[model samples]
Target: MDDVDETPDSVLAARARTGDAAAFGALVVRHQPAAIRLATIVGGSLDDAADIVQEAFVKAYRALPQQRDLVSATPLDPEAVALATTDAQLLIAALARLGERDRQVIGFRYFAGLTEAETATALDAAAGTVKSRTARALARLRQELDRSGVRGD
Candidate 1:
């Protein structure tokens, strides 16, 4: 296996976020099996799971931030991967607890990195409404994280 094949998923994702198509392709190749397994578990059909995984990856690619130099922003120590995985799991669980509207606003504003106006357009709401929803969603997400004993360090 080459260096890219041995690279961690978080590293690949970081590269993919920086507009590296090959890195994204590597990510898809590496994680496709697990993603398919997850889709199968949730969708209950292998055929449907493959379609769902494809769509999900497409959305994920679209949602990646346009500009972020995160890979070099923080040096990766041995514990970084474990910490990142734990934090991601915590955030995902917290998001799952949110109401649908709250989730949508958070996903659009943060996950998709859309401006309030853009989010407003996507949500069919006014910019002010999007702003309000984003604030409320953030508050709710904070509450969820706090309740889960996830501390920002």
Candidate 2:
């Protein structure tokens, strides 16, 4: 595919899954900056942000099979919908600023579109705990964004 054809994340993901190291490298190149920024926002130092991003990508790769399985079971297209929505990018950036528990809660619930019960199962926490963490993480994100001059009103 031409460079112009490289924008689709699903394509990149599929390539990466087949042991295409170049595709996986491209994915890392595409997402690392945002991931590192997220790591830094989550209280990691600049030096450690790179490491955190590396780890996140590793985790993303490892979880890809399950994600594919889930996608196959559902008809909805998360990639298409996410590309069309501004909230997707905002949510990713916001996730970087959350603590580990808060991040996992948000990632599983919002990004993964899992129900509270499903999130609880994935997180090994009570459903109520997932709900509470989601609430607190969102509130904290709003507060942080406001402080960072992201909130307009």
* Pairs of residues at least 3 apart in sequence or in different chains that clash in candidate 2: none
Candidate lDDT values, in order? 0.78, 0.68
Residues 7-39 of candidate 2 have per-residue lDDT tens digits of: 566667677776676777788888788767755
lDDT of 2 at 116: 96
Models 1 onward score TM values of: 0.62, 0.49
Q: Give candidate 1 misplaced runs (Cα > 4 Å).
A: 1-23, 31-75
Q: Per-residue lDDT for 130 in model 2? A: 86
> What is the number of residue pairs that collide in model 1?
0
For 19-86, candidate 1 gives per-residue lDDT tens digits of 78889989988888977764454334689668867877888788788645556655678698798888
Off by over 4 Å in 2: 1-7, 65-85, 88-138, 142-153
Clashing pairs in 1: none
